[model samples]
Target chain A: MKYSGIKVLWEGLRGNMGWKPLWRNPDPKKSYDIIIVGGGGHGLATAYYLAEKFKITNIAVVEKGWLGSGNIGRNTTIIRSNYLLPQNQPFYELSLKLWENLEQELNYNSMVSQRGVLNIFHSDNQRDAFVRRGNAMLMSGADASLLGVNDLKKMVPFLDFQNSRFPIKGGLWQPRGGTVRHDAVAWGYAKEADSRGVDIIENCEATNFLVKNGRCYGIETTKGVIKSKKVGVCVAGSSSQVMGKIGINLPIESHVLQAFVSEGLKPVIPGVITFGAGHFYVSQSNKGGLVFGGDIDGYNSYAQRGNLPVIEDVCEGGVALMPMVGRARLLRIWGGIMDMSMDGSPIIDKTNIKNLYFNGGWCYGGFKATPASGFCYAHLLATGTSHHDAKDFLFNRFEKGRLIDEKGQGNQPNLH
Target chain B: MLIDHPLLGLRDSSEFIYMGDAKLLNRPNWKSKNSKTKFIDYGYLRKNPGGVHKELWYHEQGDRSWLVVTRNTVTHEILKVELARYLKRKENAK
Candidate 1:
């Protein structure tokens, strides 16, 4: 049913019984031209774009669980294109533009909020670095502004600006970067793709691939085997394990990153804020709860829960940045496994196996890259070429030693 | 999480710094014929198993020695801990 303000009133008067399921639960078909392995945001968005733009509709998205079960629902819901490297900036900028028109395109409210993101700098060297990054963002066709100390004090007065330990000097602001309702992204894409004749098979786990002479022709699922001409696997943290079935060992390791939310309170934070001296970031949600998170758990794990040491470290950063948050009680905390790549960047390229593609190694930045990931991956699968924006996410960069180490943190996946 | 340190007894995980998969214990030889490809695999590809994992940890705040700790990735349960000095770097290493 088409939804509008009038529909709400109509449903209210008609006793609210006209609502229907968001997407149909379809059985696995015998064959599809293309099969997306994981039905998360990227998978659903790939299906959506392939039908809407590339005109390829014989597609099937197989999910092991329901929608909103993965990182799409588990992220802290922040979005930004504030990257420094040229290899990353343009791709994320494209995703940010897509996020701008996403609701109208999908006919669903994903709540894309461009409330602005602020990265406070604690030292003069960091200030210079922010200036360089802000310049790079502008050079890559994205909006950025370096704010002075006075502007920051006027903007977020709750910050501990006068602290002697790590005084907040200034900040880099991106007015077009903010948060979006993350899971709604999955639902919007799923609904639109399903409506456009793409089948989404939930609760169907892909166990193995049917590969002969290195060309993947089908997938073996729990339900049954289904043939496909092309197979693209973008299963985030599970990338290593899923592709392991085909004897492909990726340059990616899985690590758990935790996110937290506080009990609902009156509006205090205006937009997203990052503590420069520590690894903490926070933004107030639409429901008045403060959503925040810090670094990864620094180990290899598949568990969706985390230990308390990272929790205490996150709280310390929060308290150091905004003393008011120390009083707010913690409500919920969850973990998502990150496909931490060797160089701390993502890879979206065709593998050595013909007709079998890979798109993962997203680390903790997958949520923000969802839209562009789908768009570029669709372009590659449909046209058999890399999108101009995603040309640098090649699998052979390690062999060439052309590492796009954004943080320059070396080969440590957990640090990224 | 508590690490059952072989020498230090039970200690909080915060005292130790985590290094990834203990598979790194097998460092590729720089003098081999296929060392280039082997180093790429050594520096990059990993099993990243979802079940049992043997990883390395440094007692940075205590004994300052590296230890190989076998733990379940799914349950975070420590099964065993041994000093890294006692383990062979590679099966053929002298």
Candidate 2:
């Protein structure tokens, strides 16, 4: 049912009995025109756009588990397009724009909050880098502004501005960047796609690909063999494993990235604040808990748990940035598998195996790129050409020596 | 996670810096005719197995030596640890 204020009011008057399930739980069909592996945000969004934008309704999103079980639900929920590289900024900017209209388009309350995201700088060199990044964001039709020490102090007075180890200088602020209810995004897209005659089959794991004479036409799943004219794999952390079933070794590694939430407190953080000197970023959730995360556990692993050392390191960064949070008790901690690419960017291109498209290598940026990744991936699947903004995310970029290298960390997944 | 270093005994994994697959030490000759293809393999390709993996870890805070660590990616269990320089010497001897 289409949700609205009137619907809510009517439901409230009617004892809330008219509300229905967000999306239908349908059985897997024997065949589909297109099959999207993984029912995370990217997969659901891809199915949604494929039906809504590309007019391809005979699609199915196959999932191993229930929706919102991956990085889509395990992130800090912050969204921004503050990228420096030309190949990345435009694409992420489009995602930000799509995020701006996502709630209305889906008729679901995804909580797309545009409270703003501030990347604090601690040194002159870092400030210079942020200045360049902000300029790039502006050039790419994205909003960005340089905030001085005084400006940041007015917005976030609780931060430790005079830490002896790493003094706060300024920040790069994106007024349009903020957070969304991460799981709601997956649910919204899944509901919309399901409403448009797209089948969403949960508990169906793709065990292998059905390839014949260098062409893929279906997948062997836990449920049964399902046929599809085209297949798109967007399993974020399981990219390598799933693609490996087809004998395609991806230029990606799976690393466990952890996120944490603290006990609820009064609203303190104005928006998202990223620590400049280290890998820590935090924002206060609507429930008053502080949601935050840091670097990935530096190893290749598919496990969804992390060691203690990374936790200690992340706490150290939090204390260094805002000493006030040192007393806040951590409520919960969880990890998501990250598909970290060598160049710190993503890949959304077709593979040599005919009719098989791959969309992964999102690393830390996956949550923010949900909308555009799906839209462009749909464009690729429909038209058989890479979307204009996503043309540079080809698989052969590595062989051609044209790495995007967003973080300037060369060929290192963990470093990125 | 405590990594049992050969020389330094049991050390916290935090004290070491992870540098990914130990195959990185096998540098390709840049002057070779097929250097481009070899470099692509060296720079971009990796067999990130979900099971046992041999990777490089630097004891940056303790011994200042690099160690090739054989660990299970699925279980995070360390199987073996050895000085990378010794492995390099052994490869050269071969």
Candidate 3:
């Protein structure tokens, strides 16, 4: 049943009870050509692209829980291509391009809004650095614009621009940066993948991998043993535990990242605004709630909840930037475990084990990289080569000392 | 979370700065063969388990002493806390 305006009109006239379930909930099969562990945004997108682009329909995405139960539904939903490094800029730019046409390509609306993103800079040196970063973004074929204090005052007059510390001087804006409906991405990809004959097995956890010699050929799941020609693991924060079953240690740490939303109010914030001297970044949702988040809890932990100190710190940052935020009643707070990589970047490459791949280590920024992570991981699974855009996100870079450390915080996952 | 400090009775965790896994104190022999690979593994790889973990937390705003805290990552419950120097002395005795 294709969803169109005519279909909607007919359904509206005829009882309006003709809506169907988005995707199938089929039992697990004996084997598949490829098995993607972790049916989050990345896994579902990988399956969707595998069928849509590579013409590979014999794939199964096994999830420990239901769809939209992981970071896909637990993120701040901000998307942007305003990266600085040569390795990260082109990759994120590709993601932004994909986000532009994702709703059309999937025939589902993910609410990819490009309301623009403004990264505030405090000091003159920070402004100079942002100027250089803006040039870098422009060089990578992405749009960028610098705004001074006067322009900022005209745009968002509510900011505490004259604060004693961390005064806002200017900002680097990306006009094409904004938020999206995060869970819709998972559902759309899952529906498309299921429509293309790819099986999505929910509540089936991959307990262990069938490793013989140095190669992986299958997985032992809670359901049963499932054979596969190739396996790709995209289990975000669970990357360490999932790969540790094969005696492989990763340069990834699991830390709890917290985000909060306030009670709905009149529409105020235009787009995403990030504080330069602090870890706070905020945007207003269509529901009029102010959605915001700060840094991770700055420790290694698998708990999906954060401590109170970090919450207090994040709220202080919010109040410091926008004094009006202190008046808004805090509605809700949530946390998701982040796979903080050693260099504050993602990893999408084949592991040492043959025919087995790993695509975790997204740190705190996986939500914005959903499409490209899937596209690149699907390309790797299909052709046995890293996609050109994701070639720098290899696992060997750590051992080879060619790390793409964007933050320059070497080896310390907490600091990154 | 309140971390039970060894020197000071139960104190707020905000007073401490978390460093990382306590195994980092076991720095590999740099003069040995394959020091590069050893250092790379020592510097990068980690066994970030979801169960019991021994980590380094510095009492920056407190007594300014390094302490090893054994805690559960899943529950975020502190099990035991000990001074790092004492633990090092015990390791050197071994």
Number of backbone-clashing residue pairs for each candidate, in the order shown: 0, 0, 0
Query: Which portions of model 1 miss their true places by more than 4 Å?
Result: B89-94
| Docking level for model 2 | medium
Candidate number achieving the greatest DockQ relative to the actual structure = 3
lDDT of 1 at A117: 96
Stretches of candidate 2 exceeding 4 Å from the true structure:
B29-35
lDDT of 1 at A77: 93
1 or 3, greater by DockQ: 3
Q: How well is candidate 3 docked (DockQ)?
A: 0.89
TM-score (C-alpha, index-matched) for candidate 1: 0.98
Candidate 2 structure quality by residue, lDDT tens digits, A1-416? 79988999999999999989978888888899999999999999999999999999999899998887988988999999999999999999999999999999999999999999999999999999999999999999999999999998899998899999899999999999999999999999988999999999998899999999989899999999999999999998989889887677778888999999999999989899999999999999999999999999988987889988889989999999999999999999998889999999999999999999999999878999999999999999999999999999999999988999977888889999
Q: Which candidate is the best by TM-score?
A: 3
Worst 10 residues of 2 chain B by lDDT: B41-50
lDDT of 3 at A411: 84
Clashing pairs in 3: none
Q: In candidate 3 chain A, what residue range of length 10 has the lowest lDDT sum? A: A1-10
Judge candidate 1 at residue A225 and give its lDDT.
100
Candidate 3 regions with alpha-carbon error over 4 angstroms: none
Chain A accuracy of model 1 expressed as TM-score: 0.99
